[model samples]
Target: MLVRLVYASRASRELSPQDLQDILRRSRDHNPAEGITGLLWYNDGVFIQVLEGGRDPVNARYKRIVMDNRHDAPILLTYQEISERRYAGWSMGQVNLHRLNPGLLLKYGETQKLDPYRMSGAMLTALFDELVSSGAIECA
Candidate 1:
């Protein structure tokens, strides 16, 4: 069985692309070891991420994320068990909203901006799925 956990958090300080890249690098290195896959979307100092894996590893990772000093005020948006992984093989996919075409986000009920905090967990996930399907976001 697979479990998916989604959360949104505010960066503790100004974030640079290098910081995000480092995070993704570490994640890509460690997640595959634990059989985890997910997507990370960053926009305007906010982070929305999903982690999918075994219940134990995913929960442990989420706990670590909540305590990570890079970001704070983590809010749980969704957590559920699924029959299969939606992001298999992608240890960590990234969506940098800062550079994405605004038109892509507008297709998901978002305005010209990518403010995911205002979206419900369901809506947010739906948007993520759409982005993935559209090939607007890619994992390294």
Candidate 2:
């Protein structure tokens, strides 16, 4: 069975641009073989990501993420069986939230900033769909 898992976590330490790129690079290299695909968003020292794949792989990946020292307080936002992949075109895609319009953020969130901790899984998933439609996601 296929599953989609969404989670949010705060970086354990301050991260630089290179640090983010490294994470993306490693994911891109590692996910395809595992049949994983997802979108990742990072801003204000927090990360919001969606992982889609077979049940076992997805669950194993989530466990590793939870144990990774780079992340602190990782919270599982959503997990469910899915009929299809919403983001299958990329092994791992990145969203630059800094460039998004404030009005867009306010539409789904209480403020002009994205606080995945405060948003519902459904809302965050909707926002991610909008991001894909708006061409805000970058892929290797």
Candidate 3:
């Protein structure tokens, strides 16, 4: 089954160019090797990512992410199983960085305050669009 997860974590520090480079390198190495795919969005001192793949691989990656020192206490904002792949061709996936502002996010109907699982795909898509328009992410 294809599974999708949306999660957020607090960064240990403001992301530097080198930090971004390292993440890009690691993501490129991990995605194809593990059959993982997803999108990552950095904003407001938080790293929000969406990962999809087989249950085992995805879960394993999530476990490792939870333990990684780069982030602190990863929070699973959303998780679900889907019949279709939203991001199928992505290798280590796409990374988009956005300037974090609560007010800007709130324009999307309390996104920062709401539970991720409670959001519908349309809502998620809306947020994704906003991020893209704001230059927070680039499509793969």
Candidate 4:
């Protein structure tokens, strides 16, 4: 069965554009071989990421992420078995939320700011759904 895991993290320091590009490059390169597909959004020093694949591998990836030094305080927002992938085409879709919309943010347990650590699991999922539907994010 496929599994989905969502989590949020704070960057240890401000990241340059090159740093973000490297992360996306690595994600795109590695995810496909492991059957993982998901979305990642980074803004205001926070990162919101979802990973979907076999339960074991997905969990394993999350473990590695927890140990990664680029980020701090990784908090899991959700995890579950899924009937289908919400992100199937892109290995790692990227969202741009630097200029957030308050109305949409409120719909997903968010304020005018982007703070995934403060959201509930269900709300995080709903926010991801919104990201997909509105093309707020796109594939790298």
Candidate 5:
């Protein structure tokens, strides 16, 4: 069965631009073969991502993510069987928070900041859907 998993984590330490690139590179290289597709959003020290694929592959990937030393306090935000992939076009698209409108953020969130911890998984999902529609996602 197909599943969609969303999670948020904090960086263990200050991440350099190269560090972020490495992560995306690895995901792009590795996900397609596993039938995975998703989007990654990073801002400040926080990371919020969506992974969609078969149950086993998605679960395995999340397990590895939880064990990765670069992340701290990883929190599973949402996981459920899905009828279709919302981000099938991207192996791992990236949300460009820099280009995001603050008004859009405020529409779903309490503040202009993107804080996954403070928002419900449904809220984040809706925001992501809007982002996709708005062409705010940068291709991986």
Candidate 6:
């Protein structure tokens, strides 16, 4: 089954431009080999990411992410098992930080601070469309 996890974290002020670049590079490199795919969005002081893939690989990646010293402990905002792959067209996808906004964030339930499971398919589609349009994430 394909699994999707949406998460957010507070970025540290110490994070430098080079550091962010490195993290993005590493994420791109890691995803494809592990059979993982997703988009990462950053704004304000938060890093929000959506990961989708096999259960084992996805879980393992999440473990590594939580242990990584670069990012703070991420809060798992939502999780869902989907019948289809939303980002199958991309390998190790990414979304740039500049494209993030309140509307985009709301797609992930930021405005209401609610769970994604409660969201409708239209809402999810809107969120995915925004990510695709942003053209933020790059494949390694």
What TM-score does prediction 5 earn? 0.97
Residue by residue across 1-140, what tens digits does model 5's lDDT show?
99999999999999998999999999999999999999999889999999999999999999999999989999999999999999999999999877688888999998888889998888899999999998899885
TM-score for every candidate vs. truth? 0.90, 0.97, 0.74, 0.93, 0.97, 0.72
Give one digit per residue, the lDDT tens place, for model 6 in 1-140. 78887776667666676776787788777678888888765545566677889999888888877886656757776678888877776655666545455566565665834234455444554676676877745554
Query: Which lDDT values do the candidates have, in the order given?
Result: 0.84, 0.93, 0.70, 0.86, 0.93, 0.68
Please report, as a residue range, the 10-residue window in candidate 4 with the lowest summed lDDT: 96-105
**In model 2, which regions exceed 4 Å deviation?**
none
In candidate 6, what residue range of length 10 has the lowest lDDT sum?
112-121
Ranking by TM-score: 5, 2, 4, 1, 3, 6
Q: Give the TM-score comparing model 6 with the true structure, all chains together.
A: 0.72
Return the lDDT, model 5, position 64. Answer: 97
Error of 3 at 110 (Å): 4.1
Question: Per-residue CA lDDT of candidate 2, range 1-140, in tens?
Answer: 99999999999999999999999999999999999999999988999999999999999999999999999999999999999999999899999665576777899999987899999888989999988998889895
For all candidates, the clash counts are 0, 0, 3, 0, 0, 4
Candidate 3 lDDT score at position 48 = 69
> Which lDDT value does model 6 have at 55?
90
Tens-place lDDT digits, model 3, residues 1-140: 77887777888878887787688678867788878877776655667678889888899889888998888867776678888866666654454434545565576665565334455555665676565456555543
Clashing pairs in 5: none
Candidate 2 residue 10 C-alpha distance from true site, Å: 0.5
